[model samples]
Target: MNSLENFSKWLQEEGRSSGTIKTYLQIESFQKWWVAEKIADRFEPEEVTVLDLQDYKQFLVQHARNKRGGRLAAATVNKLLQVIRTYFKFLIETGVISYNPALKIKNQKIQKSHNTVRWLEDKEKIRLLRKINNPEGMKNTWHYKRNKAMVYTFLMGGLRVSELAGLIIPDLGLAKRRLTVHNGKGGKERDIPINDDLFQALSEWMEIRKESPDEIVFLSQKKGKFTLQGIEHVISKLGEQLGLEDFTPHVLRHTFCHDLIIKGYALQVVAELAGHEDLNTTRIYTMPGERETKKAVNSLSMGDSF
Candidate 1:
């Protein structure tokens, strides 16, 4: 096998999720750039230097344009740099490199205008659930139940879209009132307690769901496992009915985190439930929403008595 194939096997052995492995293998783009720039006569792992990485960073910032014809975002550049660092780390471990030259390099700073977490307000949540419960426009009762179960899993479980997609039959511990996320991001596993609503929805779906030969939890209408795009498309179509813009499963996830934090759940507890690798990510939920901020300011106003 080639070095890239070897690296992929190593990553799998290390329990990295498939998504992470795919992203890490994107180093091929860097290899192409290395050849195009004539950094080396050919792309050799041993010839890589910190200077070359620095030049590449400069290229990303000053020259690279995304598919939309805009400069690569700071976060995107940092993610690519992280991939480069990981590649070198693998090389060092395998004795192909003496050290990782990208060690001292820092990522570009990202500025925040406001909290980027978008979640449904209580009213929006109620409306969404009502639509799902009634689904008057939906003639297929089986799909309605399946979609409801999926949405509840997102809104209550705080599961990443990929994690939900990876769920299998045995992952649901209905009687125990919790579900196991065995293939979470970075391959970390965790259990999230199933609330009354989620449990009911899931139980109902399970009653009618046709058994998958692969033991998949959420099968598509065609009796195959649902693709990531298929899952997102299902949720997006629901959003359209509610007149919600860009309402994806991620919004439900954010709502799950935001609801728990605002209800006074401990930060550490929330972080673990959400499988957030960084506590700082969960802390974003603590930032008040626009409506909450407005309410806070309005509370100080003395009405007509003034």
Candidate 2:
């Protein structure tokens, strides 16, 4: 069997979704590099080694061109490396290779500031809520109410847009004021409790949302299941309306975790709520906002403050 087919079977056996399998397959730069560099004279999995993986990482940094006419972003490069790492791990398990050479290859370092993620300031959040509560047009439309609930879920529940899109009717635990995120990153599932405001918003939206044949909780303009991009665009529009610069799903999620940390929530709690597999991932959200950072510096008396 071909390598792709073999990898596909292994990923499926490991419970990766079909979409994930397709994405992994598309991350083909490593194979291209192996062939082009004459590392093995031909693309053979068993013959690959750590030195080859190391060289390919350098190639990605210096030679790879992104679609926008720039070097690959650190995050993108790291994602590609992750795919290579996983593929080699699969090969090792299958005995295709004696050992996994990609195991020790380090990912590219990405500065959190370079990520361009920002959350709403307290005033901005208040302004957004006020706008949701007092819409000038459509005082009674489901679309307006649905958007309000969605926005609250993103901020308060710290849900990713893809997770929100995957929700079903049963995922909402209204009586208990919690929602089950069944499609979190890496297919991990977690339950997050809703704040009173979010509970009320969701409750009101559910009352107005027209029932459809599909079990999906969120719906699009045509009443079909909501798509991931649709949720992103909704937040983008809200950001534009609120004068939030470069607003997106990650920003809302980061804002959620940031607010929690500043409010004295424990790291473990925040990590669980955010559905982060690693506390290190959650720690990135703790990076201080400009206002908070400035306040911290000012709070410390300068040297020789007798």
Candidate that scores best on lDDT:
1
TM-score of each candidate? 0.91, 0.90
Model 1: lDDT of residue 278: 82
Per-residue CA lDDT of candidate 1, range 1-306, in tens?
Answer: 988998899888888988899999999899999888875666888887788899999999989999999999898999999999888889999898886888987898877533466889888899998898886778888898899999999998999888888888899999899899998878899999999999998998888785547678888888778999999999999999899876999999999999999899999999999999889778889888877788899988888667
Model 1: which ten-residue window has the lowest total lDDT? 108-117
Query: In every candidate, how many clashes are there?
Result: 0, 0
Candidate 1's C-alpha runs over 4 A off are 135-137, 211-214, 294-306
Off by over 4 Å in 2: 39-42, 112-115, 294-306
- Tell me the whole-model lDDT of each prediction, alpha carbons only: 0.89, 0.84
